[model samples]
Target: METATIHDERTEEGRRLTLHGRLTVRVIEDISPRLREMEDDPVPLTLDLGGMKRVDTTGAWVLYRLVEHRTEQGFITELTGLTPRIEALMAQVGKANQMTTIRHPIRKRHFHLLARIGAWVEGGIYQFGTFLAFLGLTMLALVRALMHPRRLRWLAILRQAEVVGVSALGIVGLMSFLVGIVIAQQGAVQLRQFGAEVFVINLVGRITFRELGVLMTAIMVAGRSGSAFAAQIGSMKLAEEVDAMRTIGMPPIEVLVIPRLIATTIAMPLLAFYGAIMAIVGGTLISWLQLGIPPAIFILRLQEVVPLTDVLVGLIKAPVFGIIIAVTGCFHGMQVEGSAEAVGEKTTAAVVQSIFLVIVLDAFFAIFFTALGWA
Candidate 1:
């Protein structure tokens, strides 16, 4: 219970503030009010700390502030009788305060903009790195399964295939059909004004076979199966089932991810081809009912107008889109931590990221094919 004693004395020379006893945080409450009322004269001041038996950062701060206030009034200050230990402590405290006093003159708006841009760039890099790592791990698992066929889980693959493909056929087909009908109606109306309504057959056939069919199918699967994959895996993560598999020397990637990834990849092309056929059927029906073109004539014209290249292009894009969707879903799922709220967030992110990547890949494919004279 060593109490601090601070005494200020003025003489013809200048002023002197004598500090003794334990000048630490505990003594601060007792010393504050009296010190605040002390004079801050614009003259040389002396701080005598030789009597001080103990000093902490708080006490040093108080001494530094008193010296600073007097110095700011066009005065000089000095500390006398400091041992090596106390001097070193005061030096460190002074350095800390000096850092706080330093400031760079920059516009606040520009500073904020730079901070935000930097944060965004950092986040982008982190996400890209994690995605590459996830992709590599998945590829390794697939390669291992390929090398050892017995390690592959056939039942799981079949089950996932059923979930990702067969169960989704009805909704995907119906949606593609409705979209095709809309396209045919719109194309026919526009072409009718030019006495070329029959060309609507070419429009529907080419667009559905080359672009809309597979693109729409990918989006549908992302919204349906990608979200499901994330929720399922995330739930497993929350239950520590993934950890258990790892503990038992079973690679969770092979057990959980391989089946889903392979199933989605295989299912995508089939779904895309099926969706294209359904879209063609819908367009043909619309042409027959609304435009008075017979279904047989529409199918005949579709065959004549749509080339094998367009179908090939759509099917080729399907597997890549499936890979993106599956990888994104599984990656987000494995990232899940904390509670069920995290599962919901990851599930939503899986759907959104899958759709975004599908569209971007579609754009690149379109450009690449066009440059290759396939457009």
Candidate 2:
């Protein structure tokens, strides 16, 4: 048998309720209806169970129900008279609730895989969206350039030239010179085995004019200028500078993008041309030093081996590379979210994606030209 009694009375500061009982399962069932009576008082209620004995899960559950019912009235609850047994029972119940939510290892792994797949899908979609935005803006810019020639600012174009073109010159120069030197040195070694060291000139010329010069120059620009554009524009976006430009009735694409597109388009071909010259010069120097060939003979053989078509082919690829670089930069910049880390990540992605696409495009051109009997 179970027994209990509740005495509710007023106190100096508030109301106090005392329950005295052997809190067995039957007693809890009887007291549940009485506990609901405490809700009439709007003041804070304190449950004093100092005389509670033999309390079990049923009693703890009754207490929980009372606390929940009191919550509906927005009254604060304080549970006192917590004996060790009652405390332990409550803790066990709470822990049991928590353990119910424990997940299996296989389930967790499945979720992890799903999360990764979701992330990859999201990335692909975001990149595709950015590419579309870049294309749309590019089309708009081209239309404006054709229709509103007087509105084009030459000063902005020159500044873009200085920024994207001149700023990238040193890196392009160094890379091309090193690439030329390495190719010449390797060619010289292979040619020396056959006592035909002079063919190294033809090797360097054909490789440079057909592949290395254009590819290396584009890669350098992608790393240097592409990243720069992403960082600059991403920072502007983060700081709301781009928004300010829009607020001022300036088309951000016209004021910012047009200059860059024109600059890179003009500068990239010239940079490719310069890279070829530097590569030839470096190869000639390497031939003179290692292969014991005179500069005059190296230059003569280079001209004879590399046709005008080869040079034009390299140049033809440059503007395409430039467009790729510009698009990647602007795309990643606009994709920047609300964090410094996002800017850095987007900038790095811009460079890597631009360079990768440039190389891939170059390969496609090579294969296409070969198929057309043009390579």
Candidate 1 has its poorest 10 consecutive residues by lDDT at 33-42
Query: lDDT of each model, Cα atoms only?
Result: 0.91, 0.84
Candidate 2 lDDT tens digits, 219-338:
888988889889988999999999999998988777767777778888999899889888998999999998788999988877788888889888999998998898788778877878
Q: Candidate 2: list runs displaced more than 4 Å.
A: 1-115
lDDT of 1 by residue, 293-366 (tens): 99889888888999999999999999999999999999999999999999999999999999999999999999
TM-score of candidate 2 to 2 decimals: 0.73
Candidate number of the best TM-score: 2
Instruction: Report clash pairs, candidate 1.
Output: none
TM per prediction: 0.73, 0.73
Count of clashing pairs, candidate 2? 0
